[model samples]
Target: MNALTVNLRSVLELTDEQFFQLCQANRDLRFERTATGELIIMPPTGGETGNRNARITQQVMNWTDADGTGIAFDSSTCFKLPNGADRSPDAAWIQLARWNALTEAEKEKFPPICPDFVIELLSPSDSLKVAQEKMKEYIENGVRLGFLINRKSRQVMIYRQGKEVEVLESPATVSGEEVLNGFVLNLAMIW
Candidate 1:
């Protein structure tokens, strides 16, 4: 006898409240919003991608923990942008003071404010153009620093306020500068 296999397609397109409710009900769902406000729900990562992100998040956490400068969150957390958009960056960092000012309930809910630093990791399914546009949205919405990490090319593009975006090629490092003092990330180690 031969066994049949089935692959369940993920959900796509949802209302804002429906998206939040779905996320609350399912801890494993990874939700992202497009420029057109459509919701994309994806299954959790399986192997290398998950491991790499875990390591990178740890590095970010360690740096923040030591310096007491910011708080970091993995992709599961969502940030509410200025334009009524909800974004889930691969990783995010918010300044300590700003984070501390929120009430406990506010911390429990989706943050209504922008993060100081946002990081997006490129997956095989992601479009670089779309990712760059999302990064620009974050910057325009008050994100002081943003990094787009492309594992395929081992490059990181740094976005800062009132300046041209800077791309760091392989073997270089990215810093948070004034946004997150003493927070430095080496792309070589991350990829």
Candidate 2:
């Protein structure tokens, strides 16, 4: 199913703590909040999508472990962006310094900072346009690099701060550039 969005700004403005409590109470549903106070409920992925997501997360996590310069996160980790939007990229990585700066409580809740790198793998229920918009939001919120990967289209949209979006068609691998430093994602597993 596609995501369902609810505009709750008119009735109630959810405080950060209230939102966190709401999320904690609803453990089964994945939720995201827009900067404008719209709540989005996302559906779970299918088997194929889940497998691909695992591979993508594993690769990034392994790289992060080896690189020793950053921390990696899976889809379940939501981050509170600078613009007040709560986002959870499919796979994400944050520089060690940025992550270390967070207080223990901040780290316990949705991280209060954007990731240095983010990857959004398009699932059957996801909209490419929406994913593209999210990538742009990441850049705007200080993400150094972002990728919107479409397996069906075998395409990857690379987003870099202060640079134009770059499209790669059927690339076997995509580099993390300076942001990730020596990390490369193998698209064959994702495809």
Estimate the Cα RMSD of every predicted model relative to the unseen true structure. Answer: 5.7, 0.7
Compose the digit string of candidate 2's lDDT tens values, residues 1-191. Answer: 99999999999999999999999999999999999989999999999999999999999999999999989999999999999999999999998998999999999999899999999999988998898998999999999899999988899999999999999999999999998889999989999
Q: Provide the TM-score for each candidate, comma-separated.
A: 0.84, 0.98
- lDDT scores of the candidates, listed in order: 0.77, 0.94
Question: How far in Å is the alpha carbon of 14 misplaced in model 1?
Answer: 7.1
Per residue, candidate 1 scores C-alpha lDDT tens digits across 1-191 of: 11122222254455556657777997855666554565656556657778878877887888888988678898888876768778888889998889999888778777777898888887766678878988899999899899888889888888998789988888567877887787788666667
The prediction achieving the highest lDDT against the true structure is 2
State which candidate has the highest TM-score.
2
As for candidate 2, its clashing pairs are: none
- Total clashing residue pairs per candidate? 0, 0
